[model samples]
Target: MAVRMLINGVAADQVPALDRGLAYGDGLFESIRLVDAVAPLWSRHMRRLVESCGRLRIPPPDTMQLWSEVLEVTRDMPHSVVRITVTRGIGERGYALPAAPQPMRVVAAFAPPQVADSAYAQGVRMRVCDIRLAEQPLLAGMKHLNRLEQVLARAEWSDPAIAEGVLCDSHGRVISATMANLFAVVDGMLLTPALDRCGVAGVARAEVLAACPQTQVGALTLDALLGASEVFLSSSVRGILPVRSLDKQDYPVGGTTRQLQQHWRDLGLRWSRADE
Candidate 1:
């Protein structure tokens, strides 16, 4: 399948040329995991979408209707990745908001990446990116359309062996990965960087926070991040992925990472070929 897509409830692959989303990157998006026509984390995606739309002053699409469209676009998929995007709609030149803008909604589904068994079994290699995240408290934690920072950071490397790139703020505080939230197991407590200043708050990260009793959120430095007994990255699509190495520093795939992986797997979420 050549990636099914829908634009404003219509079967299409293109959006308006003057769409505010295209022009100004004024939008919010969610990447959902669709299995057997059902999204395991649909609730979290919708909740985050609502919260993101509120943050951007854009109206949210109806959840029931959006669900229907998701099913329609991904009808034949056993396991797929669907992306839902909501933009502030078409606007003329200038950043000024239209008096009453009709939010543009785009829903699309595609085959997921062919994940290697070792990615979950042995774990993934990561690198620390030199591209530091700028502090923008207003845009922090929301999955907004603006992602030039991540694009640049991801461009810092091309080796497919490096599964992800760990990111830090301008002050050298560990924030997250290029596309996932990061967690470090220090001593015995679970520690994740607080996203109050920057970074995306991932759904899988939220689940871990709720599931782990000994969890703490704070501004973690790179030195403090690498001092952990174990490390892992979380994303709604990938679940929990154990970090085997950050550059040359190696971390063993420990029990805590596996426990969370099994937790999501028990929810019927597909991890990878390894999980099967």
Candidate 2:
């Protein structure tokens, strides 16, 4: 079936070319998992989108209307991936913001890849990417459309055996995976690199923190991760995935990782059953 997309509350046959999101990557997006026609992490996704828009100086869209559109689009699907993209609307051929910019909202629903669910249970293999993330504090931690870093990182490996790539900042500090936030279990505590300087603060990472308050959030060096007892990564779309290997080091997906995964699964089930 052809996926449907809602653009500013109107059904669209195709995305417009003038969209700044496509032209200059001037936008933010949220990739959410829908279960039983409900987005399991809708609130967290919305919160991050709101904050990103504010930071980028883009006007916020109607949240209630947005949610309604999301539900409307995914109503028929048993399980799907919902993508919400908000752009700076159309503009003239320049970087100058339009005097009265009418921001574009795109809500799309499609069948999610089966790999998303299986990745959490079976875990995934990773490689150390050659592409390094440039530190951009202004754009840090927002899922904005500028993804060249990840694209380059992902391009490093063509082997299907590799599931994801672990990225490091220019200074060689481990930032995250190509599409997820990373967490390493060390000394009996959860350790994830602080995204204050680089990388996206994933919704799944936030949920994990909420579930386990004692998990530490701070700067993490590659050496620290290499010496850790276990490692895992998180994303809103993929939930939690244990890292089976990184570079030459390998770690088993242990009890703590399984416990957190279970917690996330329970939360997803609860959210799916909640009143829409």
Residue 177 displacement in candidate 1 (angstroms): 0.5
lDDT by residue for model 1 (36-70), tens: 88777789889999998988889889999999999
C-alpha lDDT values of all predictions: 0.90, 0.84
Candidate 2, 126-219: lDDT as tens digits:
8888888888899988999988889888889998868999899888898899988898988888888888877999998898888878999887
* TM-score of every prediction relative to native: 0.98, 0.93
TM-score of 1: 0.98
What global local distance difference test value does model 1 have? 0.90
Model 1 error, position 3 (Å): 1.0
TM-score of 2: 0.93
